[model samples]
Target chain A: MRDELLELVMNKATGRASDEDLRRIDSILELEPHLWDDYNQWHQEIPALRGVICLAAATTEHQHQLPEQIRMKLRARMRTALSRSQPNYDRLMELVNTPPDPQLSWRWAVTPAVSLVAIVVISLVLFNNRPDAESAAQTEVANNQPSEATVSIAPVIQVALLDTVGVTRGADDSTRSQFQKAWPAVEVRQFNSSAEFRDWFIQWPAARGSVCKIFYNQGSGELKLIAKINGEEKAATFALKNDVSELSQIIQQAQARLVEWMQ
Target chain B: MNYPPIERLQSGDSEAWDIVFEWLWPKAIYISRQVLTPLAPSDAEDVVIEAFTSLFERIHKVYSTESLPSLLVAITRNHARSHLRKLSAIKRGYSKTIPMNIVLEEQLPSQEETPLESLATEELFDLLEQIRLELPERTARYIHEYYIEGLTRRDIAECYGVSVHTVSGNIRRGLRVLREKLKYKVICTDDLPFRMRNR
Candidate 1:
């Protein structure tokens, strides 16, 4: 069967047989079920050979280049071989044309590193300055109240949260009304204990930035105000703690302070 | 309106670059999607940007505008391969379990015909587009011509002024690289229809 197949293939190659003869050769190979595999394998080598010939032709001059007629003959022979051996030519071409994936680039690999570095640096700066922030809050609370004679109460006074909430005395109804109105906007509610504040902060991370403090003048009623903003230290005292009576007044004062800082 | 010349773009024309980016971005993104599967959709965009950046740096020598798609495809493939390599490294180090999204088959252009029984052709195309951006210029062009354009090696050789053998070799080498790079990411080609698999 191998000898017959070889003879048939050679005959077809040499043009001793017609196009019908080539078809007959294929049919014969198809009929010999066992030899079909070997025939197909042998046929597949044609493209590689054709590739080599094409390479040679590209390198050589006109005289050396295979004539068009001969090239045609060679191509026909190669095609016959390829039909049996080559995996689908169209499929191979498709695989070649398919584009590359874009997501795996070097820029992507380094972006996370850059982002991580930025985050770490920012965190370090914030973390290191926390102690100074606490001290500033304490000082602000101590200095918040000027002598009543020196500074008269303004209709809309801005209040900033400097520290933790504690009971304070001597806040009048007008001050309390101003404070209540301001308190909602600040988004912090006064809690009875430090544990309650901690629990609230745990439940709502947004509350961690809140300012809650109590101020008391001996014999005067205690004033407690809570205000929430971002990135401010917890348990910091405010200077306004002494004068602040209502949530509304505190918010108004805080907004004024924010505006002044911006200016 | 008149458009800026490619030579102006080669000379660092920001407007020309922007025009090039706008025109090619969607196609580049589409090619990336066809090649890369392991990467997220966002990563595909990153690959396109990277490819364009590299192209911009070497725009002076890139002879023809027709070559842009092929060049972009190459960059995408190389980038994606690198990404896959990194992902593999991370996987080995962390033993993390990555979830695979099962892409649904896309509807055909004609509403009258039901969608074919195959893997998501669009998704595969998208992955391919992603991978193309990461590949080198020669390899990506070969792949794009052979697979996306459905051109024969002889035809590609004629177009590029190269031998058919060289074209085939380029394609084969490109495919081999892709197969190695995308081995873990791609499902069995046999599972997909010939059209989708070829894509």
Candidate 2:
């Protein structure tokens, strides 16, 4: 429970806390605000948990296994290392892996080479038979394949954060909440890219709903803002010049368009 | 973990390698994070993974007294310095002088001892020994699985066929005992001196 409280506050300080954690913190605050006080006093120490004494704290010890995603990456790297370390063995196999009998070995080697020559000969025969084989093949493929719905990728502004640890205090969140207030009846969706939102919009069975997707990079201030309301697509790009008022204007413009679209 | 389960590792036993990896992973990552201070935390994981692979290749050469963390701390710091040097070189190539403070939060630490160094491999085992000796066997095991193995109290309870409360209580009791036993030198961070900050 001590570790739990420490982790909660640590997450909050690092700006990584979830909505659930915020609620939990609310309860903890009412019960023991002193805990936050203790956590805050450390200030710089919070990052390192420095000067703080601990015995079996899981996080402090790094006791947990590397998260599964990282472990899988490590496993892939190890597999590569295993393959790389045995290059000599691979070379040895290449030299002596076939039958020891000279005639049999010769046949074994010749069989694959012969088959490859036949394949090349056949390919050449097929290619020489057609004057416009490449274009004909492409047209054949186009005829056979179904037409895919085109998804135009709209470039939007995304705020690329300078410091992940500190995070963008409230620039992205406030902008999102502003639209939410304007579109009280509309469903707000967050997406990483305009293309993703478009793909989802096309697949929506109930495409009649007033659903919208806003994609903000939350760093670098580059955003790919696109909204699809009632199957009508609207997109606008606002370059973040490190100005909050510019971001506000983006919301205002988006809200203005949304109001017109809804009416 | 105090004394590494390295007999098998040194003898080229794969199972032994796993045990060693499991034991050293947390310790190695913890050290790397400390070494890579004022840098992105994500880089710490990569550094430790790299250190583990390096350590694996050179397992035979490792001395009994050598801790992987201590060995890799210098390497991680060196990596950070080299990375910073590259960043500076890039800035210079563009004929722009980015301030050192803007690029780096603090000057890369030198030979000063970090608190993580205090938790040496031997001391960790010695503490484990103390916990085992001081607490009941079941309580000690529960604490070990919960803390070191990263098991939840609920999971421990289900495994033991007891209520979650029982597991929590036992673990809490064990921690309280260790705190009482260690007294001054361990446990509480309450004594950590407060400092005034501009923020």
Query: Any idea what lDDT model 1 has?
Result: 0.41
Structural similarity to truth (TM-score) of each candidate: 0.26, 0.28
Cα distance off (Å), candidate 2, residue A120: 71
Model 1 alpha-carbon drift over 4 Å, by segment = A1-263, B1-4, B94-199
Q: Looking at model 1, give its docking quality level.
A: incorrect
For candidate 1, write residues A145-218 as lDDT tens digits: 66343453222212222111122212323433344455444433443222223233333232322333322111
Top TM-score: which candidate number? 2
Task: After the best TM-score superposition of candidate 2, give how far the Cα of residue A254 lies from its true spot, in angstroms.
Answer: 61
- Taking every candidate in turn, the Cα RMSD to the unseen true structure, in Å, is 25.3, 22.2
The residue-by-residue lDDT of candidate 1 on B1-199, one tens digit each, is 2446767666554556555554555555654454455554545554444445445544556666645554555455444443444344343532321111000000112212111212132333344444444445565665555554556668889888989888766655554444433432333334331122232
- Candidate 1 chain B has its poorest 10 consecutive residues by lDDT at B98-107
Please count the clashing residue pairs in each candidate, in the order shown: 103, 16
Q: State residue B93's C-alpha deviation in candidate 2, in Å.
A: 15
Per-prediction DockQ comes to 0.08, 0.08
